[model samples]
Target: MLFKKTATFITAIMLSFAALFTPFPSHAEAHATNSYQSLENTINAILSDASIKSAMTSVTVRKASTGEIVYEANADRKVTPASTLKLLTAAAALETLGEDYRFTTDVLTDGTISNGVLNGNLYLRGQGDPTLMKKELDQFAATLSKLGVKKINGDLVGDDQWFDNIRLSPSIDKSDETYYYAAQISALTLSPNADYDAGTVIVDAKPTKKGYKPKISVTPDEGIVTIVNKANTVAKGKRNTLSIKRQHGTNKIMVSGNIPVGSSKREWVTVSNPTAHTLAIFKSSLSSKGIKFSSTSKNVRRQAPDTAKVLAVHKSMPLKNLMIPFMKLSNNTHAEILAKTMGKKVYGEGSWNAGLRVMHEYATSIGLDASEWHFEDASGMSHKNKVSSAQLTELLLLVRNAPWYGSFVKSLPISGIDNRFVGGTLRNRLASPSVKGKVIAKTGSLNNVKSLAGYAETKSGETLVFTILTQDHKDSTLPSIDKIATAITTTPIY
Candidate 1:
């Protein structure tokens, strides 16, 4: 109900602003009476309108075909791109790695195998593919079982050296530990959150007179170190604090939350170590299927000196499908991994800076003026990032002509109803009758900044590129700022 109320309230505000541009007052004597004559003029007029003028910090619009400027309001100023920065990563990936690219991870056994028993350690290695998950890990284990690997008397080796070592949450504020966003980014993150792994929780609990507590078990895979706590849910519509801790070799997640009487409830909480925990679960599952390991797995420091050689490789979904999730969800992990993977595929090791260098070079080669854009991370999770509206539009323009444009652009979230854009007017309006299927753009937002950049097709089928960036706008003023962006795109021009 709270979420719904918030959504409704925001919608009302947006609609109110949407009504402002319906009919600009034409009778003001000494007003900023700017005639809506040409596309550029109308764009400028709407941008300058008092209703939204205060919220806007900068904006830019351009034609894709001739590289002509259609509108500009502080177009050259620098501002944070937020998640919209994924566009650059995606574009660079398309040009350097192509659309058919894929990320691969492998599992190898180091000790010689005799019959159903392995004489050595089992190795879990990642090839910089960001999509590595539990399901994928499970499949590999299933394969190991078929090879008659009943037991391994050695440690499970986890290797993430395929890419340069990196930690998660380099920029997260420590005070915000309550959020998953605060967790650092890492090449080898095993269940960073002890109780949950990337939103995956194992629920095991039984109902009691006081609450569900006795025999409730929510233990993560053994490889993960756990932290336990006790949470009590008093009533409906509230979350309880369950006892959660990882001591020795176990993570116990006990819940004392309220539930409907006679109700069987289960849910997957976001498990933090998602990557490592996933591998741990896969190993355990494989063990259940006639495979056994007599020793706990250890994080391997370097490549195994004499490890089981890999005979086959399983590639993940094509870059196209993956990028879709990356763009639609604006996943920081996915974007970073893709950038690093692209760099590794081209220059090896997939260093963030290496891939960034490659991306900047490619952007320049494509004739996009990247003079003002500088990136420290592929995913624009940090405020240190900088970009210009013109550069963003130029990126869209470059993506339109690139060979991998189809997958890269198609992956971008549409205006109205994707993961984040659900019921949004600024983006959704692009799918409305006035601009239906005419624009494909990405939106960016920070504390006081909002931006939209992408391509639109004219009624004549010509592609148009535009980018709008508004920084330091007050919260109460965002509605008008959003309206200004919509007005520029949807405001009818004679």
Candidate 2:
């Protein structure tokens, strides 16, 4: 039986790879066996198990220094790449924009400030900084207070020209409004993954005088949503729904629900309406600051006149640290915004559509065959992107040699524990028992789809680049996150 196969087109596509890497030695006895055949057999065993029949798997393992494919299974079957796409984005960014790139947000006053009032318009301009919210914005507002300006004489505007335009993915439907997938990226998304602008209710269940009824405040980000909290804490580990709804263009936030008193302020995990929540927080913050202005916020249509007086300026957290957390934690919003930032740097706009084209072009120039790969969005939130396992492995191999490898490795999580952070990765079990901590890659999961790609250094002094992508719908039984992870960790490639 054909355990692994590749089309002529794929081999021809790989011919281009010759310019990128040299072939590996056939007898690097340091691996699990003397040659690639034994490794191939092991991979076949793993892929052929009856339990794996339902999975749609495509994989490729290559000696990193020599690009020699040790084992492969459906290496050319195109499938969803998920967040692994971040690697390409990260690569393009590292090569074209350099690792020290930073996104900036500037505050400008169309007029001058005097006697606690801005004589002209107040403009909040952004260059698509994803981390501009709450604390950052609060600090910005505070600086204006010190400048002897308690009020704005004109409109409080939002200048987001860094992005050509912003819109939601048409792939999502109306029901997805509250889901993160339906979020609309802005030049000023503020918190990563749309955290703060996603509406937060200060659950004041602290034994109030009103017989313990929770006090919910209306601070919708987009200003038109209602939060219905059906959550009431009963015991430890008890969970309920924190639902939110809204009509377009309204500032009224209605929250009704029961919450268990944790004896502390708790952030219950729940979906949020990002757009409405952002607008709400902005309104609330401005109101509390006594910056008297109408509820109406006009999008700054043109650049704040260069002659515009300078009142205040705000900066986001450093990009270096942000990139690690975004990649290691697999932050969808941050990844999307990062790609958008690339678009802005390259073409002066942050549209995902534009950024995506940029990513593909970069990959092609790096030796990937355009006919063998496809991409839709940088975030991988959409189900439209596709790429083969062999190609993925090849890409990772290139990234391994890139100058930004350290920052790249720091982006993936570790194994065994940790839900969405710290501990969720495949260990270096098979390659080198002591070769742990050397493999750093991204893990992806969407419905029946699963993917793992990264670099591995073996005890035999060999470094390997690998990618395993599985799609199982019928008899698809996942190997408990830990076991599947172990398989990757334990691969004896070192």
Candidate 3:
């Protein structure tokens, strides 16, 4: 009996040792391992396609709920991010400026009203309100008229010193200056429409008849730009190859090309000087409102005096509302304006340098190493801007818990949606049934670069944050990129 007991004890000790040395995976661990392998196979197969085979590509995917990275391909390699850099700008803006911040434009006077005549300068001070429209100026003029000021004996001064006098970003190509997307940035500016395309005017060309000059018109008709119509109307079925270009450093828009007899063409041209443009429109509005300027009144650009009293003020929609257009349309002017505004608010200086410093600091506070990336301009218009896919995915993951995350995510362009404001740039792309409405991301394109980065809902109900950055390809790589996103959305994560 004693011998049998000793043998049993030895057997039990051996069994315990065997269990410790060779353990079985729990159900959760097995699922995660299989999921990781499946995701890798799927993404790798998509990346091998001929469309993006020659291009430099970087991809990164992470679980939204937890910070665990599920897949990555050269994710640490830094490359130009194009407009995807807007993701960083959007997050930093929301975190620093808050969702309720509003830009303000004010009309102030240094002189007292006496018998319907003001003896001092009527100052128009702008604090970077890009949504200022012609109607707003008309309203300003009407306010002055209602206040019983029929004439001003002083100059109509424009105070655009709220931001620096730099009109265009240093990284903008010379050829792009005449286009609306590269519109000048100023504290005072005007947008012709509700799209809030500030510092630009709409040039509409309606074909009058064949073999004749097309009828051309500029919106607002404020005389801020000179129209040099050089286009002619062609036969009804002829190719409508109309071209509109603004001269360098001037508002002389040169319209050239052929338009079908019945077809119309429109282009958004950037103005030469935004501050001057705003002043001219305001002057026109004053005249329309029957508020006349005295013979001695001179229209000029000057700062508002310290003694000036506010006569009228217009506050822009909160930053939350502005994000819809800024992110949806990828407005470069708005991004830069917000950058300078952040700088001015945080460091008392409204300059790109100051604003970028603020952004860099915010990035560091959120676990990003500032030294790993470089951004010359907030809008990613600069070719010098470089960042890694991993960095962008990390940013998306970290900001998920922010108080303003809802507003930030809502601003992203949704895939397969038809509404201009709702689907944004991604409306026509990624329309596959399984992927449609499953991806919300930002689309980016520069000369030879294209990128897509945002969130995707997987088949297993897991939210994935992904970034795909591609550059240096001769052909279009968007198809392959979209395929990758589709795979991410359809692949089971569990």
Candidate 4:
């Protein structure tokens, strides 16, 4: 009887020790485990889709409040991020340039005005404002008109020295040059519309009577680009094979092929030299304002003199407001312009090298390992840009506490929202009842590459940060990606 009592006592001590080492999970921990497991299962099922099987995909999801990773799949594998890289660019810009920053275009004159005539050169100096429109140019002309500038005896000079002379990123594909998204970067540039596609013009080809040439018109036609119309308006129901191309190294745009009688086509065609284009438009605005230039006055590209007088200045909308169109429309030109602006702000040189250095510094400050990734251009137009999903999620988490976080979040595309500024690239995606309005993200695509990254609000009222990067897929994987995001939103995490 004594021996039996001793054995029981020893067993009780052993049980106590075991319990100390392996205590039961707390309520919060238990909930987290179940939530993570559920998310993993849901995401894995979507990733197993046949369409995504051939693609190299990476995914990472984290709890925003705790930075706890909920799920990851090949998260460390580096792949081209496509336009999702804009997320990094956007954050870096907000941090480096601040939300209240504004880009400015200034009108300066080297000569004195007397009796309503400028005695010397009239200068338009651009400081990398991508939002400069014809209306703003008209305003500049009006300001000059108010300043008694009636005629110019010297040259009308364009000063784009704020940035380097390199018009296109070295890593850009040659085929993308004619498109507005690949428009050349210039400190002095112009946009045709409120969408603010700088360095390009809007070409509209409306079909006229059947078998006749379609009426071709260019918006804000400042005579910088010459249009060659070779397209014909075919009978109704005919195939519209119309094509518009701007020849390489020239401002000549060729429009060819047939359009159906009722069909009209519009294209945003990039100009060869944006600085010269701005000069032409400004001259036109000046003419409209009744400001005359002598026949001997030339249009030239030169730096403004230090002693030049500031006649007028046009300030862009704050960086916070600019973020709406920039992130919503995935504006590549805006990304590049911001990058160069950062370089100019920090290193006193507006070159990609300087700008990327600032971006790298900002990334490192946000706990991202800058050495692990490569980005040749601020805009992900270059396929050389590479980033892992894990790194992107890390970035997304750290930026949550930023002062500009609200602006940043507001800039992302909301799923199922039809408004272009609100829905952006995600307008028609993930529109099912369970997922609509739950996912806010950036959508990315390139040849054989796709990505989506941002935040998802779960049913449990938790915000989850996620990044999905896919590359080299033969088929479209956007549907599968959307399903994965939907799963994240609907899965019970609590």
RMSD values, in order shown: 8.6, 9.1, 13.0, 12.6
**Of the candidates shown, which would achieve the greatest lDDT relative to the real structure?**
4
Error (Å) of candidate 2 at residue 423 is: 3.6
Across 172-217, the per-residue lDDT of candidate 2 in tens digits comes to: 4555444444455666444523333212232222212222445444
How many clashing pairs does model 1 include?
Answer: 40
Alpha-carbon shift of residue 143 in model 4 (angstroms): 1.5
User: Model 3: how far is 332 from its true place, Å?
Assistant: 0.8
Clashing pairs in 3: none
What are the lDDT scores of the predictions, listed in order? 0.58, 0.57, 0.85, 0.87
Question: TM-score for model 4?
Answer: 0.93
Provide the clashing-pair count of each candidate structure.
40, 26, 0, 0
Candidate 1 vs. true structure, TM-score: 0.76
How far residue 428's Cα lies from its native spot in candidate 2, in Å, is 15
Residue pairs clashing, model 4: none
TM-score of predicted structure 2: 0.77
Model 1 agreement with the true structure over 137-177: per-residue lDDT tens digits: 66777787777788877876766676676544355444433
| lDDT measured at residue 469 in model 4 versus the true structure, 0 to 100 | 95
Task: Give the TM-scores of the predictions, in the order they appear.
Answer: 0.76, 0.77, 0.92, 0.93
